[model samples]
Target chain A: MDMTTPLVEMREISIAFGGIKAVDHASVDLHAGEVVGLLGHNGAGKSTLIKILSGAYRADAGEIRIAGEPVAISSPRDAKRHGIETIYQTLALADNVDAAANIFLGRELLTAWGTLDDSAMEAETRKVMGRLNPHFRRFKEPVKALSGGQRQSVAIARAIYFNARVLIMDEPTAALGPAETKQVADLILELKKQGIGIFLISHDLHDVFDLADRVSVMKNGKVVGSAHVRDVTQDEVLGMIISGKCPPGAVAGPGALRS
Target chain B: MTESVPAPATPSQDAKSFADHLRAIEFDARMIGMIAALAVIWLGFNWLSGGAFLTPRNLWNLSVQTASVAVMACGMVLVIVTRNIDLSVGSMLGFVGMVTGLVQAQLLPGLLGFEHPATWLLSILAAVALGGLIGLFQGALIAYLAIPSFIVTLGGLLVWRGGAWWVTQGQTIAPMDSRFRPLGGGIEGAIGTSASWAIGLVICALIVAGIAFARRRRKRYGFALRPLWAEIVLAALACGTVVGAVAIANSYALPAGVARRLVEAKGGTWPEGGLTIGHGLAVPVLLALAVGVAMSFLARRLRFGRYVFSIGGNPEAAQLSGVNTRKVLMLVYGLMGMLVGIAACISTARLNAATNSAGQLDELYVIAAAVIGGTSLAGGVGTIAGAMLGALVMQSLQSGMVLIGVDTPLQNIVVGIVLVLAVWLDGLYRKRLG
Candidate 1:
């Protein structure tokens, strides 16, 4: 297979907070239209790696490339400018505000008089929701009143509305029930169909198998190995996680993971 | 081809009734409790005064006394609605009074050379404008500079008081323009005739009716609306009380030449009933009403008000939403400063002097009024009407206590207790809602 060019490639990304190395020379790459699962246990530097991409945290040393072109991403605003959007675990939704308001918050559509143009915003929200998940109908009620799946839909709508090309989801299904999780998975598929690459950070291996095209495992601030979902078994991935070495089941080669 | 549909759910129906029942119970409890408390207070005062509290003349005096603080409390309500306090209102009022006094007394005649013939009109205009400017300054600093309002306005209380002292050289500026004096000093027309008093009550009724109807229309149209019937009833009761007191005042007259002679004998101790209701109502009541209405509009209709609530409820969330939280904070404090300025003006005008000790301990009353009226100290829920009522209650206690010859120190203690009780009750009510 040709590893010709990736949509985004982070080369040896490292970040240290105070004296602790949160991420140490971790590398990740996503190809166009690919769902990449970043699987790691707690404190395995998975979130830090993705946050570096989303510009929530700046890498102490590394190069991150979008479309194979090197670029600087030092802030979330910078990430957005570079067409990278992150949906945090908290969803960052204002509960008291309606779905339309939640979607357009911080970047509201204003009228000629500089006041919020409610109709225009609501219309835009409806249009975006229809494009992503046509089943979502609760637009007028506050996000706090919305179901978990509906709230997730709104968060996805916000990211997509900003014309994000690379979406990074931090445990999107962490707080959701099974039904809500399914909806989020379907949303991931839908986004992939539209040619948007996704980096899904999750501890759920089942979810990785069901959704991701490629699975990259990180153990102790390092990428252990990456394999296509069809080529790697659950046991093999678990072995790599436990022993930090590629098992015989890995496709890349024997001894792919080394201590 | 017909599949038997499962029976429609009954649990949901039961829940709907349950929720309705709960809401009704909550509202009834609040209304009944408030009414009972009011009744107890009235009866207690009546008994203490040997039935003099219910006498027409004393009751009229209570109504008159309640009006000023009630009006000021209206503005205080909005200020607190945004989860802020205006501790400097008394000092600010003193300063405004000084300004009004200086201007109307022709200390600044060049500034008042205008088309308007009435010096009082120009003086009030200047005072209010100054008050608004002070508000803007305080708001800008609190909202933009990210200063705590408590510190900024505490500093303002001292600054303005000192400024007032400096302006009048720590002396009373007295013998204000006669036209201005009546705005805080009058009774009903034709030696206690009830006509003017009746007119005043009718106007109050009309205002209350207008507000209630407007609110009802909004609620009917599915806008976020307040409870209409409660408001209307409150307005009606308040208006009726005022009117009844005025009618009672009309039934009696102070002994002829008593008030004039008292004023002549002691320059400061003017006997009651010398001035009529029409002239006296304009300054304090009108000032308070205008401030209250403007603030209500700001809180309900303006983006700024919404931001205040959002910030108060959750500062982090508000910041994420791009609300300029710092700017909003400053602006709110500044606005409080300005309102205090207006209050100062009214207090000074009423006394017809910018006395050094004119508004001592008055801030406690206003703040207590706001708190008792349900302006949550924790922030994010309050109303102009509630604050007004709170002020009215305090003023009532003050007037009634004085009539019964209660010691001033004890009166303070009583009012302080009432404030604590009101807050405690509010806490319990909120807990029930939870």
Candidate 2:
């Protein structure tokens, strides 16, 4: 194990359900202060790979490393303990609980008497809201009363509240309006400044170009190539996703490091 | 051509706060509607009976009679809030009453040779414990085995009722020892009744004030609170109405000794104890109130309450959030059974007999009260106050219809219509909110 290794190194990970290989021989590295854009067509193993990282699925073969030391993650709790958090598309929030309660959902702060310390939870919620610079109040009642961006703020706050050092966000800005999207984008920048690595899974090339520091393209359950964001064009990435081969001047131009 | 930009508007800050104020009191619309319905019925009854219906004695009688079902309905509200129902409460009540009767009548004389408070306490404890155990068994089947609570508790309804019958050998157990009767049977003279009413009203006022202050403080501290003035005004109105009711009833009771003195003046027989407080106002009413208040606090002011709401709102989401949904479900059912036990104690005390059929069909009334009180059958929303109001409305219709000489069959039809209308109105409210 190298002390200065990247935060996450997934090597030769493979997962199969009843002999159908959903994810096969995939390897990727995500380092701190870097955004990894995972790109692939739908059902091409991008989500499966991300789920393995988030502990929503187990790999049949391969090793997952956190800071160069191999670790086993069998559940979402395990992932949280390893400082890895996932923000799913559904956002799995209890709609009746207010923003503060949602942010501290499973790990709510408790008073000396073991009751939910609502005041402290509110204070902490406010502090995190300040950090995100969200455009809403935490005490505006239930999450059902919140707008899209406000709900996203709550989801983000939950992950961060638990001190997630590696964030795997599944389409954070998918259904958001333009202003809401910009707010989330700003939140991502804030998180990046705090030196947390992000694995942003998306189908939008525009978001990838706007926010990714590095892009790893997956095709047929394998990482075809990985490169600096500046080294690839949207057209080149699209071509690789469609053809399983890189275009001219792309990171995998001619003979990029063979997998 | 450039896009013309309007002057940057200050962030629309007050709009949300203003909207919140408009919608804050909206949550209690069902409560208001139910109260209005009750008032309209009372006025109609008064008109039909030519003001006799509004007699203080009758009103006091109504209150006492409404208490038993009202208290049971409070617990039912919490049970429904957790997306569960206990159809076996009536059956549980019968069984518990049997336990109470057997303990106080059959077992106490044979074992202790004398009855004391402890004897009654033990009986009550045994009844509650039995109810709790039955609830726990039902909850386990529902929560752990993933069986439907409806089916489990429905089975429980038949099982407990049969158990009650078996325990009593299909006989009515009677004559609860006199020592344990005062808590559920005693009534006072006009002065004592008035004093009790005054004390009860003061306690009610203190409670209302505490709740209002806490709500206001929560809102002031940036937590959600309804409109402050509205809450205070509602509380004050409720207290005033109760006190006024008590005073008016006391005024009509013929001034205690005057009735007997007038009879003697007319050369007629004089009654003992100077007429005995105008129908004695039933001890079960106070007991019911005490039970209702305690249960309401449990449902509203505790973490257990929040858990019930959460599980009722969405069990799957609650589970994923690590809420131990099964345990919560179990606890709620257990609480419901214990409440049914309390109701059994009151009913047994009121009747002075523990018949095998003591609480027959009573669960229907309690459940009807909860549903008519705006508790969603799909769950996640209800209130003890609403349940009490519903029970009063139901009981009032039953009593007033009988008083006004309506046929029992016709009364049932009318009550059925009211229930349907209440449910339809609730559905409309939900649709509008949606």
Candidate 3:
């Protein structure tokens, strides 16, 4: 694959739920070591679009290319196998199990005797949590007992531990405090420095302005436009999100408002 | 924005209550509470029965009676943990028992000759396979077809019970194969004095070694360890219980007539004081314990067990995590069916007969045992050992009431009351913890 080939690409993805188009003819791409912010209102199909990429939902009509090679992602396991990871908006941690178990839910460590190597999992979890949240000490307690930020760290740790090439974080900072959100931003920069691509879904325009390399705005199940972060102001992205108006700096999509 | 990140504030740990101290030691309060409740029931029943309830003979009989329910209850823990129920277990047991009886009494006699060694094994395998298939069918409907488990298993309850009657045309099959009869636990089914003591000592050693191994593992990982005194105390308590049980089993002497017959058959005359033969441990009880251990291992150490709990906790999350939840659900039901099959074998062997009504209402007891043992109907929480103890508690209540000449209807009434009370107490405990 060439350097110009995007690390992840979704072309003309569409899905309908109960005859309503949740995501309609939308396309997005993320380059290696780049952060692409997905901005949209509550019902604007951003999450639905990302969910398709993460293999939580199969697109009705789409082509997903990884490093210029087309691939099929029919389930979450398929997504993980292709070096993709997602931190869902709901965090998606099993509340009854400890942090170590949640972190290694599908990919558990096993002993030579074919039993769960719980201590080994716990040791690894401690190493990850130490970097992600230093104050975290409840390794033995279930995730249900954790605070929102601590739970968010568990979800984040799960995503980053596997050396994911493409990370899709849906509202990563929604459940976190300001300090935790800042920590997430720093972590994202660190990951980008390591050449990992990120698709950041966020409502906070400031978050997009501060961290994203480029922004893609979706409105009413369609991508309004895409632009380099430095080329367009937050107001321009907001106009694209709220109305289907494409700014001069953005490349207009089929959903862009006609003048 | 500051580059340096501030440390998150820690929760206060100023005043530690007794419960906090217990938590520090990682003490399982629910397990201890169940044990205490069991003890109270035993002592209370013993007192009410004029000390007869705690005697070796009664206790031995109680253990044998509890074996079948305990076996099924182990599977029920997994079923309930995954937020599903198998109301057809009892009917399934009856159906499987009838089939096993037919195989051993009629079919096996012809194929393997009258007393062939393979007769018992083949019969049991057939029973288990049949039960598993039935369970899978119900599970498929619930998991793949999207039918609610309650409705599927409720349908199963009626269908399987009718199927059981259809198998024998409402007739009872009698006189199981001699080898198979040992599974039901009569004088022939007892392990006898020396073997019971040997097993008891081995279990004690295992208890001590398990604790030591765990401590060493925790130390290696730099995880917090329970106080050394607490560890020793716990080990001692567990070992004591095992040794005490062995002694009680050894104390339950066989009847003089049976002992005299054995001596005479051995070409020796009975002495003035007849020889004592201790009914050390029943075969069915051993089977139950083995099942308990295996189930506990599965729940705590296997990936399948983890997925079951994760699914129970949050099905959507488990699915998103790449767990094949439908397959897991199907297997869980299949496992439950297999346990019911084994339980059916035990019940049929013990009675030396299989009737359509053999295991009627047993589902209620099995579910009760799991629930009383602290398995949440809300799912994601339970233990095999706890359910086994719960079975023992239920058996004690029933046997004690019988010994005291309580009416059968009143016995059911008392059991119903206890089930509700146990669940209420468990709920209160969870609420307090929250």
Candidate 4:
């Protein structure tokens, strides 16, 4: 891989449902150690576009390259195999199971006897959760009994546990309190320092400005524009999101206002 | 990230209730509630039947009667836990039993000679395979075709029942192979006194070892440990129950005539009082218990079981986690069908006959057992041991009513009311806990 090659390159992805386009020729790229904020209104195809990358949905047309190598991700399992992890907006934790079970939901630790190594998994869970949320003590209780912040921590712990190279966090702070939100922001910075690329999808511009290195705005199922976070002001990005108007410092996509 | 770590909060020592103490010991409130209910039912029935209900003979007979339903109930827990139901188990059992009977009686006799030892094993394997195939067929329709499980199983209920009748054109097949007859409990079916005691002792040893192993594992991980005294008490209680059950089974002696026949056949003279041959543990009861243990292991320790519960808890979440939800659902149904096959063998062997009406209304009883055991119909919760106990409870009620000479119609009405009442109470208990 070239030193300047992007860690992830999603080029011209499109998907439609029932003749209605959910994502239209959207493109985004993330460099190593960079955070790209995906900003859009609800149903702006931001989630749909990211879902294709996470293997939750297949694009009607697209090319996704990892470390400059083209790869096919048709399932969540496939995405995980390529070192991609996603913390869904809903958290997606299995409510009736405990933290350990949820953290190792698909990728479980097994004993030599081919049974679930629950104690080993629990110990690993404690180690990860200690780093993420040190006050967490209810290791035996189901996730349903946990508070929102605790559950969010569990989801975050799951995503980061397996050394993901490209992490996709959809509305990571939506359900969190201010303290928890700050903790997530810190975690993003911490992950970035480790040279991990992240796609942070959010409706909050302040969150985008605070954590993201670059910003990609989507509107009406199409990418409106892209720019460095330092180059584009919040109001200019807002204009790009609301009216598909590209700022002077941003590169306009096909969906940008034709003024 | 900040370097300073906050102190972990300690639980308050004061104001702990008895329930809180139980929780501290990690006792499942639902399991205790079911046990208490079982005790009440057993005591009440014994009183109503002038103590006949508590007799060794009656209890042993009850265990045998519960075997088939208990086996199916183990599978039902997984099905219901996955937010699906198998309404066709009873009919599938009937059809599978008919096929097994036909194989052993008409087909195996020609191929392997009459009363061949291997006939029983082959018949059982055939039944299980057939049952699994039927279950998979229904599961495929539900998972792949996008049909609701309720509709698919409802159709299966009719189809399998008609198929059962068609197998023998509504005729009853009887006089199963002598070797196969022992799968059901009879004088010949039991393991006898010495074996039961040996098995009981081994189980007690296992219980103690399991507790010790768990404690060591927990300590290794620095997880909170139950008080040492609590662990000892739990192990003692479990071991005591096993020993007591074995004693009860051992106390049920063979009838005088049968005892005399056995002694005479063995070239020994029968005494004036005649020899007492204890019934010990019946084969069917042992089979049911084995199924219970295996099912519990699968549900608690296997990846497949985890996926089933996860899907039940949240289908989309499980899917997003890379779980193959459809395959898991299909396998659950297939497992249920295989269990139904085992149940069919037991019921057929016990009756020494396979009838079209065999296992009729068994679906309701199996579902009731699972529900009464605390399996939620909405999904994501249940246990195999609880379902087995639930089967015992149901069997006790039916036999208790019979011993007290209650009319059949009245018995059905009472059972129906109890099922509804149990679920209502369970709902209330869950709400209170919440």
Which has the greatest TM-score? 4
TM-scores for the candidates? 0.68, 0.80, 0.97, 0.98
Structural RMSD, model 4: 2.0
**A136 in model 3: Cα distance from truth in Å?**
0.4
Cα error, candidate 2, residue A193 (Å) = 1.9
lDDT of 4: 0.92
In candidate 3, what are the lDDT values of residues A1-259, reduced to their tens digit?
1359899999999999999998999999999999999999998999999988888999999899999999999999999999999999999999999999999999999999989999999999999988988878888888898888888999999999999999999999987778889989999999999999999999999999999999999998999999999899888888998888999999998789999
Estimate every model's Cα lDDT from 0 to 1. 0.70, 0.76, 0.92, 0.92
Better of 2 and 3 by TM-score: 3
Q: What is the C-alpha lDDT profile of model 4 across A1-259, one tens digit per residue?
A: 1269999999999999999999999999999899999998999999999999999999999899999999999999999999999999999988989999999999999999989999999999999999998888778888888888888989999999999999999999998778778999999999999999999999999999999999999999999999998888999999999999999989898789997
lDDT of 3 by residue, B308-416 (tens): 9999988988999999999999999999999998999999999999999988999999999999988999999999999999999899899999998899999999999
Please give the distance, in angstroms, between residue A252's alpha carbon in candidate 2 and its true position after superposition. Answer: 13
The 10 consecutive residues of candidate 1 chain A with the worst lDDT sum are A250-259
Query: Which stretches of candidate 4 lie above 4 Å from their native place?
Result: A1-3, B1-12
Question: Residues B110-229, candidate 1, lDDT per residue (tens digit)?
Answer: 655532367766777777777767777766765676677677678878987788788878877876666566556344212334444756666687778777766654455444444656
The superposed Cα distance between candidate 1 and the true structure at residue A34, in angstroms, equals 6.2
True contacts kept of 4: 0.45
Local error of candidate 1 at residue B186 (angstroms) = 3.5
Write model 2 residue lDDT over A44-159, tens digit each, in one string.
78889988888777889999999989999776667778899777777767676687777765566776866666767787888887667434554547777666667777788888
Docking class of 4: medium
TM-score of chain B of 3: 0.95
- Superposed by TM-score, candidate 3 places the C-alpha of residue B38 at a distance from the truth, in angstroms, of 1.1
